[model samples]
Target: MIELFGDATGNSIRAAIALEESGLTFEPRKVALARGEHRAAQYLQLNPTGRVPTLVDSDGPGGERLVLTQSNAIMLYIAEKSGTLLPSSAVERARALEWLFFFVTDVIAPNAQAFILSRDSTAAHGDAVRRLKERAFALYEHVDRRLAERPFLAGRVFTLADIAGYTITTASESELRWEALPHVRGWLERVGARPAVERGRRLFRSDA
Candidate 1:
C-alpha cells in the first residue's frame, strides 16, 4: 500500500480525496504540523520542503518506491494509475488538464497567498493580501459561470480537476459565501454527495 503523509486541510485533503475516488487503499499517516513534525529531519529527506502530503509508493513504475510531492501531482498520479476520474476523449482530457491548471494557478495560488498573509505575514502586506483574496473570488466566479454550462469542469465526468478545485474551495468555506455563487454551491453539494468525497473530507477532519 502507499503511504500518505499529511495533515488535515489544504493540499492534504485534495490528495486524500483523489486517492479515495480512485478506489485505491492507501495508508494515511498523519503528520502533526502543529508540533513541527513536518520540519523534522527524517521527514525532510522525503520532501525537501518538509511539506505535508508526501506520497511514498512502495512499488512504482519499475518496482522502485516512488516519492512524490505536490498535491495536484499526486492526485493526477492516482487518477491515471487507477484509470478512474479521468475523461476518456482527447478533447475532454485536454479540458480537464486546463481546469486543473486553473485550480493550481488561479484558485490555489491566490488562496495560499491570502492564507499566508493573514496568518503569518505582517499587516504591511494587507494590501497585497486583499488583492490576492479578491483574485481568488474572481477566479471562483469564473468557475461558477463555467459550472452553469456543464455539470462538471470537464463536462460530465468527475475528473481530477473537480477534485483539486473542490478541495481547495471548501477549505475556505468560512471565508467564501456560496449563496451568491449558486452554481458553485450546487456543484459542491453534488460532489460532496459522493461516498469517496465525504470519506476524504472527513479523513483530515475527524474532529469535525
Candidate 2:
C-alpha cells in the first residue's frame, strides 16, 4: 500500500488528487503542522526539508519501496506508476511538464509569498503583500489566456498539470481576484466538479 504523510494544504491536496485519480489504495497519515510534528527529528529523517506530503510506496522502482518528497514529484511518480494523468504523446508530455513546472516555479511562488506575508505580517509588509497578490493575479491572467485555447493546461486532456495548478489556486482562492479570470474560473469549475477531485480535496481535511 502507498503511505502518504501530509497535512491539509495545497501540496498535500494535489498529491491526494493524483492518487485518487489513479484509483490507488493508500493511507493518509497527517503530519500535523500546528503542533510541529513535521519538524520532528523522525519526520525530518524521511523528509529532510521537513515538509508535509511525503509519499512512501511499497511497490515502487523495480519492486523496491520508494520514498518521495515534493508535491510535483509525488504527482509524477504516482502518474507513472498508475499509467494515468500524464500525456501519452511525447510533445504533449513535454508541454504538460512545462506547465507543471510553471505552476511550481512561477504561479505558486507569489502565492507562497502572499501566504507568508499574511502569516507573519507587519505594517511595513502591506505594499509587499499587495505586490505579491498582483503578481499572482497576473500569472492567473496568463493561465486564463492559455485556457482560452485549450480546455486543460497542456491540451484537450486533463493531466497532472491541471491538478497541480488547480489545487494551489483553489487553496489560495481568497487572496486572488477570480472574476477577472473568467477562463480560469470556468476551468476550475470543470476540474472541481470531478468526483476524484472532490474526494482528494476532502482528504486530510480538518473535518475529515
State which candidate has the highest lDDT: 2
Per-residue accuracy of model 1 over 1-208 as CA lDDT, tens digit each: 6988998977998898899999888999888898899999999999999898899999877888899999988988898889988899999999999999998898888889777887863357778888887777777778889999899999999999998888887877777767678999899899989999988878866484
Number of clashes found in candidate 1: 0
How would you encode candidate 2's per-residue C-alpha lDDT over 157-201 as one tens digit per residue?
A: 889999989988887787677777889888999999999999899
Residues forming the 10-long window of minimal summed lDDT in candidate 2: 118-127
TM-score for predicted model 2 compared with the true structure: 0.92
Q: How many backbone clashes does candidate 2 have?
A: 0
